[model samples]
Target: MSSPLVFIDGDQGTAGLQIHERLRGRTDLTLMTLPATERKDVRRRAEAINACDIAILCLPDRAAREAVGAIVNPAVRVIDASSAHRTQADWTYGFPEMTPGQAERIATARRVTNPGCYPTGAIGLLRPLLDAGLVPENHPVSIHAVSGYSGRGRAGVEEHEGPGAVGAPSFQVYGLELAHKHTPEIQRYAGLARRPIFVPAYGSFRQGIVLTVPLDVRMLAPHADAAALHACLARHYAAAAHVHVLPLHQPGDLKHLDPQALNGTDDMRLSVFSNMEQGHVLLSAVFDNLGKGAAGAAVQNLNLMLAQ
Candidate 1:
């Protein structure tokens, strides 16, 4: 039998380039590409997309949607690496670790929407607790996240890393309007009845992200404490391959967290730190925005599709 054919529609952009690199030399799938001259030609693009068993769209939201529309083959599966269809009911949200049997859904899905970078961390941290009833649906949740410059896509990369670029900032907060693109998806998947307040920022680095959520122990039902929160997350993700829950309260040896610690891999780490006496807890998630957040996720979905 022939190996499954995979085409990456926007293979030159940040997310596309990363997906191409990760899929390079893979044995299970045959990676296909178009020449630069024909990259923008709609006919050529559609042909490439239709010829594949699976097509991965790494373009902007509009372009990604266009690419999906261009596919005429009913058998061609799609993994869209954009926010275009995240909240759409017809498309499966592509975060395998989000729940059990999610991977199987992706494997059979005709359209899979890759999750947003910030939502990946936020949902990863909150979903388990919310499911366990540790965090109520209407809980007043607030998320603060810092991502490397790469999370901004092409313009951000050019501004920070390109020649003549005015690179670097100590720290800067965005989404002041409290209406971020990822908010809907976060609320939907995190099982929140009320939208959470999200504040995101881009640091000087190129990749990786850290998202923090603070909780008050006294507000939880039964007066659940910090350890309970940690235990809930730990138990939920215990069997997950890429998601790990770190133990809370390491005595005096507990160290400060670093955002860039897991830069190159597709793994995401979660930690909970709490002080019952102080009635406070801090839940955090660390991951590579371009990895588990985007490209790695697309590839993982591709693997699931082909495995079917």
Candidate 2:
């Protein structure tokens, strides 16, 4: 039999470009992309999508939805790298390490929705603790994350690096309205009963993310402390290939976390730090926003789907 055909629907955007790069030399599958002149041609886009065994969508929310609607082929499986279907019940979430057997679920799924970049880190940290019952579901949770400007896609690149880009601010915070698109994706998959306060920011760098969620010891289940939280995360990701839980840190072991530390790799490092005296704890996830956050994640999901 011929190798399976895989098509990338929007291979010129931030996430799509990275995914295309990662898959450029692969010999196992046939990679297809429309030329620039035809990328926006509706007939061509629909025909390309309908002809592939797997279609990876890296488009804006509306376009991604429209692409999905255009797939008339019953055998054309999809891995959507957009927020359009993340919370929808029909689309299987593509974060394979999120729970037990999740990878297998993706391998067998016909429609998989890639997790949002921010939600990938937030859900990665929150889900394990909530699953282990170390943290309460209804407890008020707040997430703070800083990602490279690439998280904004092409426009972000233009704002920071294009000609006449002399005065861009070094940092800026958005989502002051507490209604970021990733919030529901985080809450739903993280098993939270209450909505979370998600505060997101973009640094001037190209790509990577450091996402943190602070916790009060008093807010956790009885007998649950920093060590307990660390152990819970370690246990959840023990067998995970790409997620690593760093050894719990003592005072002065590490002073700071550089968001760009894990650039260019798909690995995610989860660290736990605490101050018992103050009854405070901090949980962090460090990874490349383009890697695990966007393109890398889409490829990871693509591999699982290919295996089946």
Best by lDDT: 2
Please, what are the lDDT tens digits per residue for candidate 1 over residues 29-143?
A: 8999888999999999999999998888888889888898888899998999989999999999899989878888988999999999999999999888888888888999999
Name model 2 segments beyond 4 Å from true.
none
- Taking the tens digit of each residue's C-alpha lDDT, what string does model 2 give over 1-308? 89899999999899999999999899999999999999889999999999999999999999999999999999999999989999999999999999999999999999999999899999999998888889899989999999999999999999999985788779999999989999999999999999999999999998999999999999899978999999999999999989999999997899999999999999999999999999999999999999999898999999999998
Clashing pairs in 2: none
User: Model 1, 51: alpha-carbon shift in Å?
Assistant: 1.3
Error of 2 at 53 (Å): 0.2
Positional deviation of 9 in candidate 2, in angstroms? Answer: 0.5
Roughly what TM-score does model 1 have, to 2 decimal places?
Answer: 0.96
Report how far off residue 54 is in candidate 2 (Å).
0.2
Least accurate 10 contiguous residues by lDDT in model 1: 163-172
Clashes of each: 0, 0
